[model samples]
Target: MTAPITMFGPDFPFAYDDFLSHRAGLGAVPAAAHGTEIAIIGAGIAGIVAGHELMKLGLKPVLFESDRIGGRLRSEPFKDGAGAYAELGAMRFPPSSRALFHYFDKVGIETIGFPNPLAPDTPSTVIELGGVKHYARTKDDLPKRFAEVERAWAEALEEGAHYGELTAAIRARDVATIKRLWHHLVESLDEESFSGFIANSKAFRELGFRAREMFGQVGFGTGGWDTDFPNSILEILRVVATGADDEHRLVVGGVEQLPRRLWALVPEVMAHWPSGTSLASLHNHVPKPGVAKIAPGTTKKFAITDRYGTTTEYDAVIVTCQVWLLSARIDCSESLFHHDLWMAMERTHYMQSSKTFVMVDRPFWRDVDPATGEHALSMTLSDRLTRGTYLLDNGEDKPGVICLSYTWSDDALKWLALPLDDRVRLMLHSLRQIYPTLDIAQHIIGAPITVSWESDPNFMGAFKANLPGHYRYQRRLFSHFVQDDLPEPHRGIFLAGDDISWTAGWAEGAVTTALNAVAGIIRHLGGTAHPENPDPIDRWSDLAPVRLVE
Candidate 1:
């Protein structure tokens, strides 16, 4: 028998019965005539943004989602009297995502800088390496971090040059250099594990210890290993550096409020508004029109199911699910989109991460850092005992609530594979690293709640990673709808999500991709659309390498 669903805290905010009833109500809406302007699959931030943009252009968009509207941006209420909510999936936005910030502003959402609890001016971060605690104040204080990172970049540059030299011999366009370097990066990453890649490099070893320090200081997770390009570490570094200045923040009420506000902006044009819909399978063809077969016995008029157990039909479908899930449902024969792209996407790996909100009768950490008082956000690289724990202060209610987020790499996943009690013990043990004095047994009022994105069938991972050999394919996939082989209004389906652009794995990326997609769609609709300038990092030149004689 399947494992029973464990309820550690109060029930989900929305009543299960209410959610089901809402789903059922959707089926009652009469089906409109075939061939709408657009059909958006996945009502996550990407789909929501796209739908809103389409409405502004006077076009109607039918939004579809298999589960919740927020996608990974989900938050749930804490059971204890914290009077606060904890993020089950994604949290925080990078400051660089100006487009996303504008969207939130337009919707009247406000964000506050994360309040640091440990040290207001400069937070104290520690990394637990092989069960030992190493502390650092500023990012630069981390030993050997810069040297190791520089060495890795040097190696990557050398590899790129070698590859570029060969490609340039055949053709001289900047495209050749970009493609060659891109190919080299992806191949190198795919050939070995990220750890293995560093170990094998003599230059990397010289810098590896320092590299770890740098990553630890900056709170870089193993998730960093998954990228769209393997060969260009420099590119990834640039994106990371650019995003570092951005502070993590939340909308006054909740991040979900952002999507709800967007929907309110254009309710009439959105499909299944204030409701829900499910997509069965999508049909993609070049010359002829594509169809999305809906399932029968659907809960609402928007509900769809078909004979092969598929349902829902649309003139155009924009899929925003993880690349892997999209690959499974795609009809390869009819899709002009390359199959190699799908294969490369499957090879990318995602780390299993978990976030838990502990509701204590008091803001325990506040006492630990008395100077800052109770309302401060402190981000830590390591807990005395736990790996990957970051502390966030939820500025709501006294005996304030702090959300402790624990992220695990492959090693932690192995520990998670253990029995439930063992996992709980492990979590508590890790908590001791941060608070050695507090008796977790006594202070804990109730069972802790955990959300594992990796374990979710629908998600399977937190977000898309740009692993080695994957960049080219990722770029192509992001631009698929805009390619010439597709029908008029060729950019009919724009891919939006964290994985689509440089801001991949971020909310900003989702918004940026949505903006780009919307612009394309508007242009196709005969509306004037102007392209924005390339990202600042896109203008950077490859750093010249230093040569050493052995």
Candidate 2:
């Protein structure tokens, strides 16, 4: 049987999964470097992971956060909850996210199949388009046109990019083959947008414009990715090629528990620190205030000033916050990064997203309609303002949660000005048009919750989605961890976050990149990886990402 596709990159195809599972435990710093202070900004997954690993390596990591921990993995529980909650940021996680799953497994976080549209776990799915609704227990129940669109997408992938071979290479961990195929694609499609790739594909061209429009509206694996049409085809290809869209699962209780637990976890074995040491224990159970400024100190160190007028200096700094924050929220020194790196940070594009959720009395949507004998409501995908609505059932006799609406990009922008009450009403109105007989408002209990990440002062947007012609910028950021070529001033401050990774929006990227930063910090402090379990930087030259000439 073929091995399952992991997020072993086509860009930098390193076996991070293998590295973490090894007994070496992420390498070690010298005795002199032990307890060396390294400042990490943002208490999100990236920051937390970096701190955890660095602490294991005998380094003292000081973490600063502007808001709550977990970053984009924000899960807000309902007041009447039996573990029912709204996943405001990242809800569904793909099985291919092996690195992220490693942390989940370490923390004993359980997961269940997410009820994505057409997923087997979902009881039924409803697709609404052009004011028409169709109910399906599976894809086979959809009209033949949907099948044709699915086939066209497959054909487009095979014809335009030889996607099958690329995926096979990735599964086999064939670095040379993966690089050869992906290099050709980067050269050909770096400047091509996703919509352009569709229009130009022979299969899509033959399928006609209407089919293309439907493909956008009812996209496979999640739903309605039309908002991403303007992004690089390379970005879309990376997702599908690595199987990042398949077999998604949600945390059983909430994803917030993963980071929170990690903060308090005392690893079975570690360097320098005592057996009872944990990140929580090190910081006295709370992280420092948000950072306000970072600049060069007089004695070859980085001075960090937090929001509360406290200043401290560290040997090295790793920033895991959104790249835009460096410019928008903090007063950062220009000399900390090279001009090219600065331009890449400036060019990074973040997609906006909004999610409105409400707690319902029970799983009332599962009731069979007496007149039609069909489910009253289903996991819905629509072209309406409420792009996608999900029914999250906790259990029998317990209050259920419903994600009334989840929208991205343009659709998300529409909800930016509306208040929570107005947002909930508008979503209910849109959903009602599909289920005319159902009064969704009647089942709603307690106050509704809503969020527009772009509106949040700390995070300007939901997540990064690179646009066409932005691959070079991505290359710059991803390759920055191996900083031997950079000048002295730019050497100490490293970048690690989803935005700095090849796959920006996914948590796997955050984990993998944090590992990269950990390795970088170890090396900077005169440490080396165990020979048997080398990190990404140890294999950098052989597996370095293909660079496009300017």
Clash tally, candidates in order? 36, 0
What are the lDDT scores of the predictions, listed in order? Answer: 0.48, 0.92
lDDT value, candidate 2, whole model: 0.92
lDDT at 368, model 1: 44
Best prediction by lDDT? 2
Task: Give the range where candidate 2 is weakest over 10 consecutive residues by summed lDDT.
Answer: 77-86
- In model 2, the Cα lDDT at residue 249 comes to 97
Residue 66, model 1: Cα distance from true site in angstroms: 1.4
Top-scoring candidate (TM-score): 2
Instruction: Please give each candidate's TM-score.
Output: 0.66, 0.99
